[model samples]
Target: MNKELWEKAVAFHGHACPGLALGVRLCEFVQQELGVGVSPDEELVCIAETDSCPVDAVQAILGCTMGKGNLLCSRAGKTAYNFYDRGTGTSIRVVARRNTAELSREERRRQILESPLEDLFSTTEVKYPLPETARIFKTVTCAVCGEGVAEHMARLQDGGIVCPHCFRAYDR
Candidate 1:
């Protein structure tokens, strides 16, 4: 673990929270496992299982960002991440151990920062296919909600585009 890198991650993420520390360590682990440094482009893709403080750390330390189309989020509600090496087609999934869940938020933060990386996370090699449309999408207007949405995300209904929210309303 690089103290300077952790400090930089903390500065970028605003506060020294547990999520941020986990992200910093996860990024470090990914770099070590892949034998590469922070990525500048789509060479690395990160699929975060939740939208949390740690995502900011991932953006800063791993160079994976939503704008760059390399950072993806899922509503799994778990503090896990899957890092894929586009060049080598190698991937790894990392999940925080359940032991940390029993601690208070402050204690969790302290443990994440001070404990060894092996104590905080469980990692495994995984096979995941990268989606072809992950990086490309067209912007379109949702007729039902009058909101703008990605063309790929907008559903076609009655000859017009509808956002997912409006489409769900119709479904119910």
Candidate 2:
């Protein structure tokens, strides 16, 4: 990871590159720096710190890694082993490509963890709320008919919420 470039990307993402801004930040990084459209199979060259879990730390930035890098991890210097099945020569959740740059939504959350954050957030964090929850209307039953009733003829003539069929007597 180029500290300058990494910091630049972080700044472009408004500090953390935040929740969904990962892709947008990557696009900006590629466009402004790589000068090429991301092919989804692009490999990004990164500089890992001397004492970090390369896979866990860089996961969010690179999307994923082979897990078994010949080079010992920069942080712990441990040989990271990617898991494989007994019969199948396959590792689950292996990052097939390096993509710190792509659309925001398709981003694997790992990249979010590896991203360098200095500008937007710090030890301090703020939580944002979700959009308002819309109320769902269920079937309201008529007391007299004992059947599910809706406001077919109902009107708010009084301070209460009465079904249309029941409102008739009140209206009269």
Candidate 3:
């Protein structure tokens, strides 16, 4: 693991923890195993199974971010991540193993950092199709809330265009 990259990830994440270390290691493993580099664009995509600290490491190292629409959250509440390379059509799913042994916080962090990729995660080829690239939808004002929303996200409610936030389910 690169010390500089780890420092940057810790800084970005506000603090250091085992979870963050796992993420840093996971990204490094992907780079080495896949021979891929930082994404300048949406060439790399990460569908993280959790909204945890590790996703932050992935965003910092791989440049797959929510703003760029490359970092997606599956909210499956698992220490798993699915990575896809749009350029090569290669995809991988990495599931980090839980450290069940009783250890102090610092000890746990050190173990995660020092463990080999094969020991830390179960990596496998992704079987599903990769998600479509981010789209640029036109913006339209919601008639109900007078708020601007993506054209595709606008909902037709009571014959009026409304944003999802302002749309209400009608019974009649």
Clash number by candidate, in order: 0, 12, 0
| Per-residue lDDT of model 2, residues 87-113, tens digit only | 222222111233456646434444554
Residue pairs of candidate 3 with colliding backbone atoms: none
Query: Which should have the higher lDDT, number 1 or number 2?
Result: 1
Candidate 1 segments whose C-alpha is farther than 4 A from its true place:
100-107, 144-147, 165-168
Tens digit per residue, CA lDDT, model 3, 78-137: 888999988988888988977789999899999988887889988876644688989999
Choose 1 or 2, whichever is better by TM-score.
1
Taking all chains together, each candidate's TM-score versus the true structure is 0.81, 0.19, 0.94
The 0-to-1 C-alpha lDDT of every candidate, in the order given, reads 0.80, 0.35, 0.89
Cα-based lDDT at residue 103, candidate 1: 88
The per-prediction CA RMSD against the true structure, in angstroms, equals: 2.7, 19.5, 1.6
Error of 1 at 142 (Å): 3.7
Query: Once model 3 is optimally superposed onto the true structure by TM-score, how far is the C-alpha of residue 122 displaced, in angstroms?
Result: 0.8
User: Which residue runs does candidate 2 get wrong by more than 4 Å?
Assistant: 1-27, 36-43, 50-172
Distance (Å) between predicted and true CA of 100, model 1? 4.6
Q: Mind sharing the TM-score for model 2?
A: 0.19
Per-residue lDDT, model 2, residue 95, is: 19
